[model samples]
Target: MASAAFEDIAETFEFLDDWEDRYRHVIELGKAMPPLDPAFKVPATKVDGCASQVWLRPVVSGQGPAAVFDFQGDSDAMIVRGLIAILHALYAGLTLAQVGQVDAGFELGRLGLNEHLSAQRSNGVRAMVERIRSVAAV
Candidate 1:
């Protein structure tokens, strides 16, 4: 099951004026996620170009607006783990169109982390998006 809706995440970030608080919230989200099986963390699902080791497993169901997509992801870095959790909260169980509709840049910008994120972290997240796009396309 998904955590709080992405809307709730947005609201929480909006209410948290302090960046540290928002970052803490995201970290907590990551901590709450159940660990993935070691068997699923193979090189085949590894995300390329990430500064830290990361893996994503995706499951797609139904079709069109009725589609539901869920992903399990993990990262060796704590913050990256949190970022992966954010993606899952926002996208898990959503339709293919809904997944395509996620404006991650805008969302992060709204959360005020767009300018604050390091280039490497940003690139890692961009890779995450590309991976999600590819899986959903299939």
Candidate 2:
């Protein structure tokens, strides 16, 4: 899944000459995300302060120290899904501490996403980071 996500991002970056194309590419990627089960849908899982309805579920494996997140959302919020994919790449297989150490906001800037995003979208990204931090703290 991580590899596929990376490949998607790489392909999008390579194919798109402008932000509009990139956004369309992102929307296509979002379409590829498997739908979340209805059972996991809950208010507690909903990310607060987002323009869209974002759901995040954490799975803590007994064999590992890290928590893996299963994310889903309503609305055709492509950039949000892409943002989630980025987070998955950074912290999916890491220990909780290691995941916590990652500077997601900085990484977003480094990846050139922060520069392209609107204030609301940027705030949503920050909210995601805060949510991840809270989950890691548990």
Candidate 3:
């Protein structure tokens, strides 16, 4: 699923010649993401440094070495939601170690999302990276 997601994004970027179309494709991807539960919406789970309200929750099952992350974002910003979906699809089911190994910057570049993102979105991405790293470190 992860590989397919990556391929789809790549294909979409390649097929679209305009940024507007690319942005629409990204929003479509975000729309495909499952809706997060309302109850999980809380200040504790809210991610800082984001231009919009973003929430991240980790689900650790038993004594598993990896943790699954479920994320939610509320914003009119399609790109941000798309970014979150990409992250979720790539790392949701992985272990902490695997999560830490992800080359986020490189992956974003590959998706052609890194350079175009706003500063606030970039900071949010960084914050997410830090949170993942912290969890992995433990």
Candidate 4:
């Protein structure tokens, strides 16, 4: 399920008629995110299958399934960084258990991202989603 923040993004996407404008909005969302610390950009946090270098560091609060799930992500590519922000909006603040239940594709599809992204970018997004899910699963 999408979070309120993500719903907001979807609403914005709906308001913006042009794919170019949506693309710019995504980049702007990426720019708005705080940069992840360089130290966290290590191999351990790096997401595989991404065309661009990307890292996601999980920050769990509390314990067990009830723990809140949050992460800090960064990317060398601006659009990838924005993608990370979108993922953050999708999964962050959710319970660690809840994170696993999110249908990332369907939620993202609501914003029509699948049609706009290149195949590589689509794969990259899947990789990122898997990374987030894996972290929450543990």
Candidate 5:
């Protein structure tokens, strides 16, 4: 399930008539997100398969599957950073168990991202999702 924060973004997307406006909105969302600390942008946090340099620092609250999941993310490219912000909205604050249940493709499709995102960007998103799932699984 998508988080409320993600739902809000989807709602906004519904009102944006053109892809350009939607892109602007996405970029604005990225701009609004707090920057991840430079210290955490290390090899361990780096996500592969992304054209841009990207890092995700997972923050779990508590132990086991019941733990809440969150992350601080960053990207060298603006659009990629915006994508990370979108992913954060989709997954942040969810329980580790709940994270596994989210249908990311379906949720992202609701925003019409599937049609607009480049092939590489879509793959990068998948890679990031895989990274998130892997961390939660551990």
Candidate 6:
């Protein structure tokens, strides 16, 4: 498997050792992302369980078992937006089979997100993961 894009996040977290600094890093990641165009921000793409308004749109390509997908994600909250970027980093280049086989929540703990996020935020993240996985399952 290709190294996960968020592994850089884990390494960066390892050095900080403080949730506040870690959270600042998360916000920075969100700040660095290109804003999602308003046209793509529609009801059909909304993620249902996030506390913040969130959207997910995926473009799938290739054929048969070799199919791969790339996703676009956005959230109104800065932290949630950072989480969206993390999800994109982890998932964007993967084949559907690869996406289906991965454990998304485990990666959260690995990235220090599981420790820092509140229960609501964690659940929101899980919902986002499910949204991506549901798309891959199809």
Best by lDDT: 4
* Consecutive 10-residue window with the lowest summed lDDT within model 4: 36-45
Candidate 1 deviates by what RMSD? Answer: 2.7
Candidate 3 lDDT score at position 101:
77
Give me the displacement of residue 39 in model 4, in angstroms: 1.0
Candidate 6 C-alpha error for residue 49, in Å: 0.6
lDDT of 6 by residue, 116-136 (tens): 788889889998989898999
TM-score of each: 0.90, 0.76, 0.81, 0.99, 0.98, 0.93
**Distance from true location, Cα of 28 in model 6, Å:** 0.9
Q: Which numbered prediction scores highest in TM-score against the true structure?
A: 4
lDDT of 6: 0.84
Query: For residues 12-109, could you state the per-residue lDDT of candidate 3 as single tens digits?
Result: 78888887787787787778776567787777767777877777666654354555543354434666677777777666666666666777777767
Better-scoring candidate (TM-score), 1 or 4: 4
What is the per-residue lDDT of model 1 for residues 1-138, given as tens digits with 9 covering 90 to 100?
A: 223577788888889888888889888888888777899999988999899999998878777656788989898888888889888877887777667777777766766767767899889989998899778766
Clashing pairs in 4: none
Compose the digit string of candidate 5's lDDT tens values, residues 114-135. 9999999999999999999999
Considering summed lDDT, which 10 consecutive residues are worst modelled in model 5?
25-34
User: 62-119, model 4: which lDDT tens digit per residue?
Assistant: 9999999999999999999999999999999999999999999999999999999999
Model 2: lowest-lDDT 10 consecutive positions? 67-76
Superposed on all Cα atoms, the candidates' RMSDs to the truth, in angstroms, are: 2.7, 3.3, 2.7, 0.5, 0.6, 1.4
